[model samples]
Structures are given as structure tokens and as C-alpha cells.
Target chain A: AQSVTQPDIHITVSEGASLELRCNYSYGATPYLFWYVQSPGQGLQLLLKYFSGDTLVQGIKGFEAEFKRSQSSFNLRKPSVHWSDAAEYFCAVGKGNQGGKLIFGQGTELSVKP
Target chain B: DTAVSQTPKYLVTQMGNDKSIKCEQNLGHDTMYWYKQDSKKFLKIMFSYNNKELIINETVPNRFSPKSPDKAHLNLHINSLELGDSAVYFCASMGAGRGEQYFGPGTRLTVT
Candidate 1:
């Protein structure tokens, strides 16, 4: 079965520090990868996705993710973390022909310190 | 404007009661889905509909039924709600071939 794993359960970083959230997926074929962020009591917002070409994909709110096929990983990163960036991040994997069916990771909670 | 919207942002209900959550998308997407987030914040796909046809149905209980009146609307009806059913339910929509989905503000269901 296809699955996604987010190793870090919770991470804390300073407001101005850089951030990297790790993600790994298990799928037979080349998969569609996505990153999403959810604030407390709020719905998820799509940060970025990797489907076909570009390994490095940029998304909303200055978020970027790099998809590495060799490691079966898609890691989200930010140059500078803001206080408002504190949220739960999820990594998901989807099959090529599967319609909107996504297997999501457990989620990583980010806490930004001042 | 909201791309995808769900009704009853918060719902507190007693066990054994039946309730329904409605979802609609204005993005004209042909595919819609329902996901459940547990108290631990683990997300899982429950059901999916494409062009008003059921495409994917996970290992959800039979008490939970999904209805898609049209391509733009999908509703989930739960019968005999149990305490274990307390979780946040999210609605999402996607284009025909695109894997990217637009999510709605989730409905937090608390079964007391």
C-alpha cells in the first residue's frame, strides 16, 4: 500500500530562522507529491506540489518543496520563518491516474519562537 | 469567493443521532472528496466522487453514506453517530485530471 511519512512530529524554530520539514513516501510508480499547511481551527492550504517536471516547486506564502525521486522524499523549506508560519504541515502522495485520492502523512506541528 | 465550502462549521451531537454535512464547490471541478481528521490530526480520505459517480470509497462504516446530487455538490450523511466518530471532516474538490485539491473550512463534529 502507498503511504506517507513525516518523521518529525513537532519542531520549533526561531522566528527569523530557516525551516525544513521532512517527508517520505512509498509508492510503486512516480507519484504526485504535495505539501499543505493547516493553522489551528482552520482548513488546509496547499503550499506546493510536484507532478511531472520541476523537482523544485514553489507555492503560496513563500513556500517551496523539492521532490527527490531517489529518496522518495519531498521536503518543504522556507528561507526565513515568520511567527505566522507556525502550523501543522502534511505531506501527501497521489497516484498518477487516481482522481483526487491522496494518502496523507501524520503531520508535523511547527512552533515558532520569538 | 470560497472555492469549496462546507456547512455547519461546528456540530455537537449526541450518540446514535443522525446528521448530515453538505459540501459545494464553485470551481466547477468534476471531482469531490471527503476526509476525516482525527483528534491526533491524522488525515485520511473517506470517499470520492467524480461527475456525481462514486469513484473511491475507503474502509468507512456502512452507517456513513455519501450523496452527490450534482457534480458540484456532495453531502455526507452519518447514521448512529458514535463517540469514535468525533473528528473534523473536510470537503475538497479537484479538476478533472489535476491532483491538486481545494479544501473547505472543515466541520468539527463532536459526538457527546
Candidate 2:
């Protein structure tokens, strides 16, 4: 079955440290990939997305994601994490012909340690 | 200026009661969508409207209905709300193409 998987349920990283959140999608062909972040008492914000072209994509909030077709993985990375970066991260997959429906993974919650 | 906005950010009501959540986008997007985030925080697409036309309807309860008054607005109505209906409902929109969707602050529905 087609699905999006987020392995880590919770991750803790010290402030100013590097961060990486893993996301994997199971599908036949490459689907439109996206990463969203949701903070407490806030809406889900689009972090970045990979449609085509270059595998490496930069997003807002100093975040970046790499789309690997062979691995079917689109992992989010940040070289230097900030305390304000603590939030719930989600990985979503969209198929254009599916009428804009998105399949999202069980989000991963990030905790920044002071 | 707000791109996408949802009214009644927090809703508390009893089961069997009916409620409606309104969403509007000032971005002039042609597509609008409704998504449900369950207790587990798993986001799932419930319904979508493209130019006032229903495009995607997932496996949702019949009690849940989505009405698109125009391209800029989409409202969700739930009849006979149940305890399981207690979840966050989010509204989102996209431009002409199916690219990144801008999301609105979710509505936290609490059914007692």
C-alpha cells in the first residue's frame, strides 16, 4: 500500500546543534514531496517541497531537504538548530492527478534542549 | 495580510450537536481542501474543492459535509457530532497548479 513513514516519534537536540528528520514514502513512481512544520497553537507551515529538477531543495526557516528517488526518501536537514525550531515536523506526499490530496506521515515532534 | 484563515479556532460542544467551520483564502487560489488531524497527529485529506467542484472525497463519514460557496471559501459542516470527531480540522489552498498548499490555523474541535 502507498504510505508515508516517519520513524522517530520524538527527537531531542541541543540548541545550536545540527538536526535531521527522516521521511520515507512507499510508492511506485516518484510523487510530489513536501515537509511541513507545526508549532504549538499554530497552523502547519510549509517548510519545503520537491517537485522535480535538482534533488536538493531549500526551504524557509533555514531548512533544506534532499529527494532521493532511488531510496524513496526525502529527509529534512538543518545545519544549525535553534530553540525556536522546536515543533512537530510532518512529511507529506501529493499526487497531482489525485486532486491535490496529500498522504502525510505520523509527524515527528522535536524538542530543543537549552 | 492573512493568506488562509479559519474561524472559531477552538470549538467545544457536546455530542449530537452540529457545528460548522468556515475557511477563506485571500490568495485567490482555485483549489481548497479540508484535512483532519486525529489524536495521533496524523494528517489526512478529507475533502477538496476545485473551482467550486468537488474533486476529492476520502473515506469520511457521511455526516461530514463540505460546501464551497465560491473559489475563495470552503466551509465544513458536521451533523450529529460524535466523540471520535474531536480533532483538529485544517483548511488549505493552492494556486492554479498543484504545488505547495498554504494552510490556515487549525480548528481544535472538542466534543464532550
Q: How far off is each candidate at the interface, as Cα RMSD in Å?
A: 1.0, 0.9
lDDT tens readout by residue for model 2, A1-114 = 789999999999999999999999997678999999999989999999999999999999999999998889999999999999999999999877777778999999999999
Model 2: CAPRI class: high
Q: Please provide TM-scores, in order, for all candidate models, with all chains considered together.
A: 0.98, 0.98
Name model 2 segments beyond 4 Å from true: none
Query: Taking the tens digit of each residue's C-alpha lDDT, what string does model 2 give over B1-112?
Result: 9999999899999999999999999998999999999988989899999999999899899999999999999999999999999999999998887678999999999999
Q: lDDT (0-100) at residue B104 of candidate 2? A: 99
TM-score of 2: 0.98
Tell me how each candidate scores on DockQ against the true complex. 0.83, 0.83
Q: What is the TM-score of chain A alone in each candidate?
A: 0.97, 0.98
Q: Looking at candidate 2, what is the lDDT of residue B22?
A: 99
What is the model-wide C-alpha lDDT for candidate 2?
A: 0.95
